[model samples]
Target: MSEISILKDFQKRQMLFMELYKKAFPAVARYISRKGGNYEEAKDIFQDALVIYYEKLISKSFSPINNEKAYILGIAKHLWIRKLGSNVINDTIESAESEAVFAEEHLRTDKLIYLLETAGKKCMDILRAFYYEKASITEIAQQFGYSGTRSATVQKYKCIEKIRETVKEKSLAYEDFIE
Candidate 1:
């Protein structure tokens, strides 16, 4: 195909993907909630499944052998099951179907964390100070010995932007957890 055709096709596929997500999201949410999971858990699982789907597509390792909905639902199912098996989640409310979704999401979260950590020490420190420590820009600047608070804030934003770009370039989604 020509470049323009490929681009158009890609856009079409993305739109289709979004439609599938819209349709599947409610079912996935109900499945999780019915199995004792909360709305938050459902959202987390769905987002992670989408990330996995994105990664697979970008890597060209995904096959359209099945419908997109089924493919994503399958990934979510696998995620839920792994979560149950790991004991991170109690199995009391878990159904066989729900387990797979939780498990796959758990794995995806782990993978995203790993990727964030591997971004580099500076990026990690900036993220931790801004996010985990909840420090003010001035305080962070003083601690890190930057020129001033403004510089510190700018640097922090830049670092996060870098991380975001890096994650995207690698076919990963960093926005959901990054802040």
Candidate 2:
């Protein structure tokens, strides 16, 4: 894509996101609040769901849907359930309960890593180079053949966003994985 087209696409996505935030956030917020989640948690889950929804919208595999708001809310509901489980949310849980939560989250992380490796090997390599190898931006740019540090930085952020979309897709793909 040309720079101009990329800019236009970004603008379009920004408008769509703003519209979704206005039309769908209130319903999702209320649902999360009723389920014992706070404002920040609701916001986080809603954003995650929105990213997933957007990915599905752009993909050719997505079928026609009547209600975009409902779809986004459904995704948010699943994310919340996966994060906190189906039972009641409690602030003062025992050590065992905390450990269980930790283990579940760890498993999710492992799954995400596996998916990244299989589905986005190049992105995984870029991320590992920047993060795990402690490579400098200039080094990354030279290795990846990016124009410069600025380009490398932008690519790094793009890879992160791609991973986010992948993770969201996985959460939706396996009913037992989340919820």
Candidate 3:
């Protein structure tokens, strides 16, 4: 694709991502909380999933073979499972399912993190602030010295798209790690 077309496509995907994020976050938070995870854990899992999604998109390697919602939710589920597994929780059927999902999710999450770490300090800073710190666009703009919140928002979206592309290229899935 031409530069303009690629940029436009990316922008479109970013808008979709933000919308999906807004919609899925609450359900994800509730799921985690119900499973004995705290608010902080829910937030971390959600953010990690978004980071993975962003990495997949930015690398020009992601193709939407399935519903975006499922893809993102799968990532979140996997991350939550990993978090639970690392804790000394009792292993029940539900917990086992979570563990299974998490084992699958970890491989992708690990790769996504590796790619994000390689994306340099700026991408990491923006992702950390927006995803982990839960900072607003205005706050990030001020902190990053952007011209305005709009600029910061745009930059954040672009960074997320990059992450999504990176994840997609690998075609990692929950089934991959499940035996």
Q: Number of the top candidate by TM-score?
A: 2
The reply for model 3, stretches above 4 Å from the true place, is 1-14, 86-179
What are the lDDT scores of the predictions, listed in order? Answer: 0.60, 0.64, 0.64
TM-score of each: 0.41, 0.45, 0.44
Deviation (Å) of 30 in candidate 1: 1.9
Q: What's the CA error at residue 105 for candidate 2, in Å?
A: 35
* 41: Cα error in model 2, Å: 0.4
Off by over 4 Å in 1: 1-14, 86-179
Question: Can you list the residue pairs that collide in candidate 2?
Answer: none
The top-ranked prediction according to lDDT is: 2
Model 2, CA-based lDDT:
0.64
Question: How high is the lDDT of residue 106 in model 3?
Answer: 41
Query: Which is superior by lDDT, 1 or 3?
Result: 3
Judged by lDDT relative to the true structure, which candidate is superior, 1 or 2?
A: 2
* Worst 10-residue lDDT window, candidate 1: 87-96
Error of 2 at 167 (Å): 34
Q: Which ten residues in a row have the lowest lDDT in candidate 3?
A: 170-179
Clashes of each: 17, 0, 18
Candidate 3 residue-wise lDDT, 1-179, digit = tens: 53234435734554555566545555555556567776677677877887787667656656643445456666777777776666443444454345444434443444535767665679878986776556789989998999999999899888877776765776754333223
